[model samples]
Target: MFTFFIALVCIVFFFLFMIGLFLTIKSAFKFFVTKSVTKKQLLSSVIGTFLFLLIFGVTAVPTFGNSSDNTKKVSKKSDGYDFKSIKLGMTQKEVSDKLGKPSSQNDRAITYGNNTLYFADGKLTGGSPKFIQQQVNQKNSNDKQKKADDSNSEKSAAQYFGSKSTQKLADQASYVPRTQISNGNMMYSETISNVKMYRIDDYQTGVTTVYKADESKDDGLGAILYQGKTVTQEKPKTTIVY
Candidate 1:
């Protein structure tokens, strides 16, 4: 509303400036031609014309200055990636042409910051570390808390691996139960694997159901239901001194 007011005032000033300039030119011409116009009257017309132009120019500067800033903000917003341009079966060169260079790359995949694009037989297959691809197209702040929940889920999900005492520690860290496997059996994600697997534990049965990360869903890390997998907390193998 305030911007509109400034713009309107600038237009009014410009209109007045044009009218004053026309009147001043007419008075000057009459003064020189007929010699009947008073010098004081002509001088006053010139002064009024100068004031109008000066005021209009000053007001016009800030109006355009504000518009320039708005244009920059729009430019910044449009600068983000058009991920839809990336299609499956695109060659590595084609992907690079659209998205520029990757942050890191190897034989199978190229990474853009956190998001990785996977390839097979020198053509695009899909992306890796699934969380990043899910986050790529989201422009709002609504999912921020859910992301924090996922990280916490990963950290404490491993806590469900061991004895009852360990499960107590996992329970204390706050897990958002994503799915119900059965009555009294629930699925929660413990992102204990670097390869992204799901570990589901039953609170009452003390039985944990593990699922491999589903490649298809945005919430691929949670509640996809694979059974009979052993839950072992990740630890380094001990080296024996020879």
Candidate 2:
């Protein structure tokens, strides 16, 4: 509606400018031919031309400026995710109500807790085959990470003499388990391993281990790191323990 109003205003101003310019030129030509150029006629012509140009400038400037603003608004709307109302743990229905249906759904899951929802345009679309595939992928990735940690723990334990020391070593070498959360536009990974990682493909920022569960205290190893490199690394390796 606002757009239509602005466009209508512009069209009206454009026609008015054309008419004013035409009259101004006609008056000037008449005065030149008759050799009776009156001050009043010249003033009227100048005023008409100035008014037309002024109106044209006014209409044109806002049109260009408002177009940029409208572009931003439309872009946000088309992205299928509203940043304002989104929150973690929102169900597919809730997200749909806020963002409407997704443009496309692929094999992706935006997982939180036991409830896994389909991911499309950074938001949860619904539960379907694509969602299931994403769940399987996540489970597979988690399983692989668990196995890796176990292997590393076992290796660390073998290097330790006593069983108590082995257990401690195993715990120390384990990577922090993370749960994925998103603003529908950005993904964040939270873990009790004293590290909070945020990832959007190659762009990542987070902190390193700072707390130990057994001691229930900070380990002073807490360090923040920003990954400026792209995350286009090779596909993750997986091993099935069974």
lDDT of 2 at 33: 91
In the range 103-127, model 2's lDDT, one tens digit per residue, is 5433465433333455565544444
Quote the lDDT for 164 in model 2.
Answer: 22
TM-score of each: 0.27, 0.38
How close to the true structure is residue 88 of candidate 2, measured as C-alpha lDDT?
A: 40
| Tens-digit lDDT string for candidate 1 (1-242) | 99999899878877878777777787777778887868776676777678667876776777787897888887656545556788767888998998898788888999876567888899876675443355443522446767777666754544344222334434544753345665755555444545355555666666665555776877565443344433334444799999
Candidate 2 residue-wise lDDT at 119: 55
| TM-score, structure 2 vs. true | 0.38
Q: Report lDDT per candidate.
A: 0.64, 0.50
